[model samples]
Target: MSKKSTIQVEKVNAHIVNWLKTYAENAKVNGFVVGISGGVDSAVTSTLCAQTGLPTLCVEMPIHQAPSQVNRGREHIEQLMTRFSNVTTIEADLTAVFENFKSIVPTVPDLDKVNLSLANTRARLRMTTLYYFAGIHGLLVAGTGNKVEDFGVGFYTKYGDGGVDLSPIADLMKSDVYALGEYLQIPASILQASPTDGLFGDDRTDEDQLGASYDELEWAMLEEEQGKSADDFAGREKIVFEIYKKLNASNQHKMREIPVCFVSNDIK
Candidate 1:
């Protein structure tokens, strides 16, 4: 399985915890705040932040979220608080807030566009909520994105889940994050659950949306990094490689820094 880590799990855990602690200390922030999505990434990120021995706030901002997601998030937060004194939690139910926003916005003819916009809206709402807590509590917002989502596929929402003060696991792949989750003793309910953003208020999973499994995407990412292309593969491998390339190219805007319109002094 690609889940196996190339490095020592114990040392990686210690290194991340130390890195988080030093970053918080240097920034003069109290600790870290993470948006708990009932997924392995958030569960692992929160656990790592708790290990920093500084304040770790897990905020649940649900907008018509699934009960399973909610339950898993609560379970992880409860376990975290029990295991670490610095860990804390808050539930900011955003169902009503989301409904209000939808009602106020102008309706459009394109249902597909509206649905996609609202799904992203759900993520942005959660992002706003996390920053709110971070602002009032003097904490840094720790991101839960892994390498596959953050860079390989650009699966995250722009300025939404992607808008974070720091990313503890952005360098780790999806499989690597699961490996750390195992080391961190993350709750089995979360560790075993299918990965989802839960933004659509339904049971659809990340794979259903992405059209390929994380393992396949990981293989494609590595292959592309090693200078392979879709033309080199056949059958399912070709399909998955094409999917990865399409998403990687389309979502480059999300993965890269915002483009600035530069004007020379002469032009100005």
Candidate 2:
């Protein structure tokens, strides 16, 4: 795919439709699975899959998403229920899984380290659930991540959210995600909702973790990639630079799969 795609929202939609059709036919996939977090990224991805005329199973794995956030996710799924009659919503509540394991270690690590661990745990649980559905019904997991979230910094949990077989929006930026949601006619309420990880209370958000808002982070990342001074973003340049730097610094390992050496010189 092109780094700069000329594909408009409508064109993206057509591509999604054809891709779904071809992949399903080739793999003989019976259904689709999507992890909907009641956030914009997830809602948009799930809606795209559902609209593609498959039995897209939208799963809301609310480990710690607030009641309001849970409601938002439910509402998104409900909205899809009307359009995709084959869509089935599942509540993959992960509270028990985390609870059973959180105290197993007894001593808590540092805040940053613990938070990173928790984030990875949530993502792994989500992947497990997606595969659970896929294994039972021969479905494909429709991962909900955009370029800004997954590739720019590799800011996802490898063997977790990063373990998906296919991603529908892997090439879109944060801004483009909103535009696609609008193009897909997702509820305006969700369109306006902030990008979040739903990993904590209502106060927790992805921007908080990255230390930069959508606009600032995107601009800085783009400038950095172009070999330009990311600090040219005016008074807030420092923050933006920090955001890109932090994500890149923290998620370095998420980008690569396990590497191998020519121990036996075997192609196997």
Candidate 3:
């Protein structure tokens, strides 16, 4: 991390926790509901929610989840319960739900297409499950997206992982999330674990789908944010920039609110 980019983990944590308390108080919600994915983003976000002293429900809804993924998520939740009296953990395995959907949904002609659709369905299903729990408890659904994935490349599924009542860390950079995670005393195993969306039958990291690691994508995104020209990059850096641009363009829709039809008064 750059000296200028260094995060004041204490201050940031306080700010986010206060924000959550204020928002939940204003919204008159009971607590927060977050999908615990075993990634640093979720770990940090859930911890921040817990720090608010409100009831924070951490839901682990695994759909055919890998052992490592499940283990990390459970450990994080256990850590949270150990530290915070307000933290509650729930395990809702949706493997059967996903299988039933596969069995019932009309089969697409292509296998790859089917797999992709199912992956997204997994995300939406998890979102649905979270909201179901949240609605009954009068809690707001807290999202775990970071700045790079949420905005830079628009890497989240629309109304799926992207669906939320609040995004506490949507503004934090991926690298800085790690810094804050360390400050929050998140488990080293989770902090060091490879990040995944846990949406596929075969495990694939986010970088595997995005075509560039978070570090390279963040650098390219920073260059764009700083108004640095892509022409300045040479060789591999240029290639990464192109990849970044393509992803940013392709997933731009996910970064925005739902589009509504407009009819101008002049037109009428």
Candidate 4:
């Protein structure tokens, strides 16, 4: 969790941009489409796509999103458009769609379950919107997930934010993503903003839900990779290690390939 040495931002940026371009060309897609949530991950992702010199469409699908989040997203899109001619922005406000769906769905007695389900519904709605744009434009849906969120903790909603055509920054750690964001000159508001999924429509951060900060989670991930267990640590470290392990175990279904039932020849 200690401040690590700086990464080779220039080289990393160029590598990802070139990789994106090559992938798009090989896939026969026109370009990339990304959902901008006014967060650092999305901002960095859209910028990387724009750098590919291909048509990068940044879509803002706000479902009861906070005003600050919407403002920051618009700011980043404006900046991106000014910098790259290939970039375009669109706003698909799905507030009414979400409300209508809520009204039609059967009401549950458990408010907690309903809230969680609705939060995930928000993410899935945005995912569907992104794919809609990608479908019409012949573009790939670029994911905005980072290492700690996507693999370490599985913080994203399955078939929601996790659903994507390609992940440009999945391998990079949260710190590494911020480094790239700095090098890419992402807007200061986004860079300084606390990392949130923006699904709950409130100010609760990822740490609030995960029970640990990204730095702590990153440390635990490294420790696990080095063959260390929760027993090795005490106090806060142990707490975080357990939290990381619990999430990793519970969310393994998200990280691995879907299970399938096969039929043997004898059965036939």
RMSD of model 2, in Å? Answer: 3.6
Tens-place lDDT per residue, model 4, 1-268, is 5535267989999999999999999999999999999999999999999999999999999998999999999999999999999999899999999999999999789999999999999999989999999999999999999998899999999999999999999989898999999999999999999988888888999899999988899999999999999999999999999999999999999999999988899988
- Alpha-carbon RMSD of each model: 1.1, 3.6, 1.8, 0.9
Against the hidden true structure, what lDDT does model 4 obtain? 0.94
* Per-residue accuracy of model 1 over 1-268 as CA lDDT, tens digit each: 1435575789999999999999999999999999998999999999999999999999988888889999999999999999999998888999999999999999799998999999999999889999999999999999999999999999999989999999999999888988889988999999899999898888999999999999889889999999999899999999999999999999999987889999999978
Candidate 4 Cα errors over 4 Å, as ranges: 3-5
Q: Give a tens-digit lDDT track for model 2, residues 93-210.
A: 8888888878785546588778777777878888998899889988998878888778776756787877776888888887888878888888777877777776654577787777
What TM-score, computed on C-alpha atoms, does each candidate reach?
0.98, 0.89, 0.95, 0.98
Model 2, poorest ten-residue lDDT window? 1-10
lDDT of 3 by residue, 206-234 (tens): 88898888888888898888887769888
Evaluated at residue 148, the lDDT of candidate 2 is: 76
Instruction: Order the candidate numbers by TM-score, best to worst.
Output: 4, 1, 3, 2
Q: For candidate 1, what is the total of clashing residue pairs?
A: 0
lDDT of every model, 2 decimals:
0.92, 0.78, 0.90, 0.94
Point to the candidate with the largest lDDT.
4
Whole-model lDDT for model 3 versus the true structure? Answer: 0.90
By TM-score, the better pick of 1 and 3 is: 1
